[model samples]
Target: MSKKKTAMPKITLIVLLSISAVLLILLGIWLVGELKDSFSDPADGTEPGAISTSVSGGDEVVMLVNSYIADMRKDKTLTIEADGVSVKLDLNEAGAPVDYDELESYMKSKGYDTALIGQYKTVLEAQGEPGSVYNDEYITKKIDELAVNVDTGSDTEYELIEGGVTFYRGSERTVFDKAALADSVKAALDAHRYDTITVSTTKEAPEIPDLDELYTMIYCEPADAYYDVDENKNTIVVDHVVGYDIDIELIRKELTEGTWTEKTFMKQEILPEVTAETLPQKYFKDLLGQQITYYNTAEKNRTVNVGLATAAVNENIILPGQTFSFNRVVGERTAQKGYLPATVFQNGGMQEGLGGGICQVTSTIYAAALKAELDQVSRYVHAYKVSYIDLGMDATVYWGSLDYVFRNNTEEPIKIVSSAKNGTLTISIYGKETRPANRTIKFRSVVLETYMQEMKFEEDLTLAPGAEKKIRSGMPGYKVELYKQIYVDGVLQNEVKINTSKYSAYNGLTKVGPKPVVTDPPVTEPPVTEPPVTTPPETDSPVASGTTGEDVPVVETTSAPDPNSPGI
Candidate 1:
């Protein structure tokens, strides 16, 4: 304390104030690591200390982030889109685009981790350019990975949808036929190998030239058929006349399907639409204005099983999404197929069977297909009313639950010819021969509402009250209502909804009796004791308890009503 005076020596002012306060605390720790490397990685665009890049900086900062990811992937392309379809990241070839500002100039000269090496510098920015990568990892490299980018199409322009079915027709010569032939739209390929960079659609479909022997056996030879864009529906076959015969058996049993479409294809041309100048006023007014008839009381022997009103036809034509089937061409009516019995509807009434009364031949071909408006493909509903037709405009079939189907769906092709003996069933659906006769349907029956008859009790018979029989009267049930009235040439045009026929309520079976057939208490004869007459007491000696040698009248037996026993 007393001699510490040497302390005043002050070795050069304390070594220049301790080296200037250790260089001001190492320049404030190098200015706080240069402001923490400019805020760690303000998106790694470099500029801070100019060196220590955080990806732990190794391989010379992986060679300056692989030379700015090779000028940011040289010929880039990118593109990308969603829902409405679009895609193009063509990573190579003349395909490029993902430079995004040279990925921020190589995430700022990669002091290594511009986000863990920016996923190896976005595949060195998807390689078409940027190099110095180890030795071509698929022509480029650098690992440090982390992936999950979906939205496919990085390989090149993409497209994939595939669903279709279209059929168009609006002719005098084309309106929108559309499918010239990208293989006419039937794609189902899967050759695989990543679509080998996609490119396989040469497209073709030619064969459709027989236009009835290529234009009537080369008649003028100039009868063209050309169809380019490769050819399928772009169909350009110029012309071919007369080709008819419809009734597609429900289109060969619903859609000319397969097992190889079961035999059916043929083309014709005989009078296409009856042109020899309209075939004599179509036989003087559709064959003398058909008078409609079919009266065949089962040819004498009677009993139903007839195809009687054989085959007859004045005409028939249909064309518009066209299709009308009925066992193809009404082919099964037999007497060995000659067809001739008449009258039908068996079982629940008018008994006869083997096509009895052919539904009066399907109700006279359904009131000539509803006076030629024709189109009722599979009808059925005739439990009773079979006086030819009429009744919600009659249409019946039992084969497949009612069927009279129809379809001109219409623009042309229609013609049906029919005719049958003594009485009638004339059908004449001809078409396009000046196109007149506007329409005339008329059925009109009106309020035929009559129900209440589900009694189904079978036999509760106890008859004879007023003794006046006939409870199920004449079995002539009648509750009819038919309305379709649509006349355009004769005026009155408008009345639709045509279907309401139910005549199944006929209850009349007279002969009613006196009621109470069995109330349980009626056989009273149990007290007739003729058996104890002095009893057999004096039996032996007298032996005649009221004279009994042969008078065995003990009368005491009656017990027959107990069917299963239980009656209060």
Candidate 2:
């Protein structure tokens, strides 16, 4: 019995010990779980091994990293220096020169975990931190700013004076290597320090302007002198310009050897074919042809228009192979240009219109040009026969529609001179005469057919009874053939028909008084004596008469006159 009681006590003690050991194992597991929970990130539920050291959130890590960056940049200065150039940068400004990777390594040295450094970078990215301060753009900008102090003098300048061109020299310049300076600055910044970086430079000579381009800009071909109308409607001579040429090889040699002077580049002058001094004498030395026409001096408006048109055409020059346009030279006639209304032909009748008498001027010029042997480009005769010029010889012109054109067929320029004095208007053409002096030309008109004018009579209420009044006088129409007879030394060379012209006939208008009223004598009763028998009288020898005995009164009848007669 004593042995059994002792075994039971020992068994009880063993059971209690087993229970404490099991509880101790379970408590150890619970404590480990608590410690893991305390160290892990609660938001992501990450394990303790993945936890950051001390700095838990992204904001905290960023704060730590930014503080370190600020401390490292405090009161520091970075400068990019070169020959005669220096550019200083503020280290404390925003865009702190430290890179994110360098900052991460710095943070690691400060006992911050790699994961925490990653979180710092994430936070910086979210907040738009670590901006492009030391990038290519920044480097270029800083270098350009530094280059302003290094003055490379102005480039070569050229001036064209009188006969030649002159060039001025430029000074040398120094330039810095932007890439090398940028690398040095970034390396210093990445090392978390500031220092003066010396940028290497290169010396460059001043560039010369392209000689070929300069030569082209200053070269030109010689031009002949010519005549042109001035603003005041006066003919003036335009002087020719002298051309020049330079030897590019000589200029290049002088420039290369640094021996060029203000007059180092020489040019040769080129002469023009026609000089200004002798052009007028050569072109207008002889009188080619002339024409004179007479106008009624009493017609003041028509006279004035003729004179104005003459003035517009006088002293004008037509170059060789160039055409002269009458309407273009004498522009549209208006009251503002001092033109007056005068008689003009319209629709087979005469009416008052502006520029009425200018056609006379055109006709006069046409005749003069024909005598001068100029080629006619365009010409139109009048609608009806004009008294100022013969049929088939008059040239008509209207604004914008009609023009009389002629070309200078000679090899030299021709000039026109005109004048209007009293009742005489004269136009003369002067040019280098190429025709034989003995040759003479004349134009003649021959009537081919004639048309008689017709007369029409109408009753008028204003004229006296038994009286007549004449309105417009009728004009006879004719078809005429014009011939140009060429005579050499008073001998006919050839006779050629130039043109055939037809003039329209106009009917004469006349107003006549109405016929006078007449009353027949009252018929008297023949005494009521109708009882006497009347015997038909017969004459011997067969007398041809309707009445017999006592010579009955004879009544005579005549036919009406033809109205188309000239005396109608």
Candidate 3:
């Protein structure tokens, strides 16, 4: 309060001091920013305030990266050089190994912006040089060049060899350098990518022919020695020869010398392994097991299928310790092979499908095999119960997946005699029956659990009024166990457990009346009425007659006058 006289001087001094302080702060900030800009490195995404004394500027560096990207993006061609010829393959075709998206992503990660990317693509398309993308065409051309024709056939006229069969034999060609060709192609492709390429001109013959078809063609099947009970004759049929097969591996070895020589007549005669003299007395002479399968005769197609399958298995021989696959023996089931469409169980329901009735033949054979004491290799039970055979003893087979397999466990080879007649499928196993004559084998199924089907009702409009019809009668499901029981001299010797099978329940189906029932009114009957009584005219009691004591009206001479007579 005492210094009020000099207030204006004090205000001017404070204003000047404030302005100078602001100016100094601003100058310090400018100096700091300039120093940071000068020392910043372009590699760290920091722009420099001034160019460096050495090294290219940012624009030049960007131009270099774009050029590299353009070089990588150029259209590539795969050139396969071999046999003094260059095979130019366009890389834009199928099977090419380029990834444009991946390259673009990699370029972007290296700080390539959209403008630079577009500019690089333009330059890449403008370039005339083709990038390299080597592949396998070189091997193919070289292999063709080194290929040589071979004549391994004889000039002898075609003759039906002892087996009464003939097939044409022709010259065969081979490539000697097959292995080297593959290696060379691989090496060439690698060498284009800076790897060493190896090439060769030596030729190798092609692999030997498959002999399975030839063996089957040349094989002469021997007739099985069967006993004919009707004639009481043990028909001992003479065995025949299964002639001639060439050793494919041996031929390949002989041909490896690279000489195109005519094949030598390398033939080997095959003799029947089983004959009447070689047949075991106990094998194929006595019946080991027999089983019969019954089917509905109304299923004509299914019956035919069963017959076909039976014929396929008829007289089939199983060598000792050899496994028999049902699918392999019967082959594929198709309409072309004489199988027909019939109802089969599939996917938890009964459906009409191909190869339906073959299961009957399989089940019959399974029963016979069980009785023969053959070892079971693989078997599957049906999802639902089959009426043709007992529960747990039935076998169902499907091609490719499900198969009925069994091995002949006996020392003697076994034979199967199958026949289908009048909807009856019978399978018999004949082998050396070593068991005691009094001993018998039987298969019995034991029921463990039974499932009663519940009735299911549904409305159906196709039925008569107030009618209820059963569409399907439910079959009771069962859990059964099969047992192989053996008896010797009329006494139970032992019981062997075979398998446990569970069958799913099928519900009973019923069709009921669709609409509510309509009833008629009660009928009314009329009451009984008797006819009215009628009284005769009153007649005076006639005086008592003298003799009869009866009143009788005396009739005048009742002869009516004729018309011709005059009325009086």
Scored by TM-score, the top model is 2
> What's the residue-level lDDT of 8 in candidate 3?
86
lDDT of 1 by residue, 398-480 (tens): 65445566765344445566665444445555554343658656667664665544322233244332223333332344566
Of the candidates numbered 1 and 2, which has the greater lDDT value?
2
- 2 against 3, candidate with superior TM-score: 2
Worst 10 residues of 2 by lDDT: 559-568
lDDT of candidate 2 at residue 13, scale 0 to 100? 94
Per-residue lDDT over 123-224 for candidate 2, one digit per residue giving the tens place of the 0 to 100 score: 567667663355556655776777767655555566777667777766676776777777777777666566787777778766777999978876778888
Instruction: Output the lDDT of residue 283, model 1.
Output: 35
Candidate 2 has a TM-score of 0.52
lDDT of each residue in 1-568, candidate 3, tens digit only = 3644657888999999999999999999999876455334434454443322223343453356445544554555444333333344333331233344655686677765434444333334444322334445654553444342222323312233553433333343332455664565545433333232323333333344444654465544545443221232212234444445555455445545535434443456555565555655536887888899787667777777888999998987777777778998899998898898877778765667887788888888999999888999999887777777778887889898999999988886788999998767799999888888999878889999999877788887776545677666666789999999899988899999999999877666777666644455455565876645876565664443335444433222333222111110
TM-score of each: 0.21, 0.52, 0.44
Assess each prediction's global lDDT (C-alpha) against the native: 0.42, 0.74, 0.63
Give the TM-score comparing model 1 with the true structure, all chains together.
0.21
Clashing pairs in 2: none
Candidate 3 similarity to native, TM-score: 0.44
